[model samples]
Target: MAIEEKRAWIMAVVTIVAYGTYLALVLNAAAGAPLGEAPYVYAMLWTIGGAIVAAILLNILAAIVSPRDGGKKDQRDKEINRLGEHIGQSFVILGAVLALLFAITGLAAFWIANVIYLAFVLSSILGSIAKIVAYRRGFQSW
Candidate 1:
């Protein structure tokens, strides 16, 4: 597999794992209390930070393991990335719109924040999946 593909796999897996861990921790903590009252900000921050650190570490490890790849992103890699980002960004936009609507409707801050966080997670997952598919199959020109 190309290094980009490997990176995509890493990102997808790491995002899922980090987010899953955060969910488990938050849910466990909130078992007796309401979700809104749970300690979510810290959990979100920690999970996001963890994901970033994990991705960086894993990418570095991958590079060291396969020194030949050298993380060279070519034209195809760039195109695939652009396509994946474009596809994945839809969720972000939706989430923003929803957040705005929720805010306008005076919804609780917890729901809005969670919606945004979920959108980010979904975006990463979908984007990584798209990149992986494009790499495994073939990227067709528009």
Candidate 2:
């Protein structure tokens, strides 16, 4: 697989794992209380930080494992990357709008923060999926 494809896989896995861990932590802390009452800020921050570090480390490992492919990027890679980013950015916009609305309506910070976090996770996963699909099934530029 190309280094980019490997990167996509790493991103997808790391994001999913991190989000799942955050969810587990928050839910466990909530116990029988409301989700908004759960101590989620620290968990969310830590998980996000961890995911970023893990993705970077895994990408470095992948580059070390395949030095020849590490620095290679062609037109296809660029196109696929752009396409994936465009596809993934939809979630970010949606999240921003939702968060803004929640804030305007005087919702709890927990809801707004969770919405943003979920959007980020969804963006990463969807982007990674799009890249992997383009790599595996032949990308077509339109």
Write down the RMSD of all candidates, one decimal each.
Answer: 1.1, 0.7
Candidate 1 scores a C-alpha RMSD against the true structure in Å of 1.1
Q: At residue 53, what lDDT does model 2 achieve?
A: 97
| Candidate 1 ranges beyond 4 A from true positions | none
Per-residue lDDT over 33-109 for candidate 1, one digit per residue giving the tens place of the 0 to 100 score: 88888878888899999999999999999999988889888999999999889989999999999999999999888
Give the whole-model CA lDDT for all candidates, comma-separated: 0.91, 0.95
- Model 2, span 1-142: residue lDDT tens: 9988998999999999999999999999999999888999899989999999999999999999998886599999999999989989999999999999999999999999999999999999999999999999998898
Worst 10 residues of 1 by lDDT: 34-43
Which pairs, if any, clash in model 1? none
Kindly provide the TM-score of model 2 when superposed on the true structure, using C-alpha atoms: 0.98
Runs of candidate 2 exceeding 4 Å displacement: none
| Cα misplacement distance, residue 142 of candidate 2 (Å) | 1.3
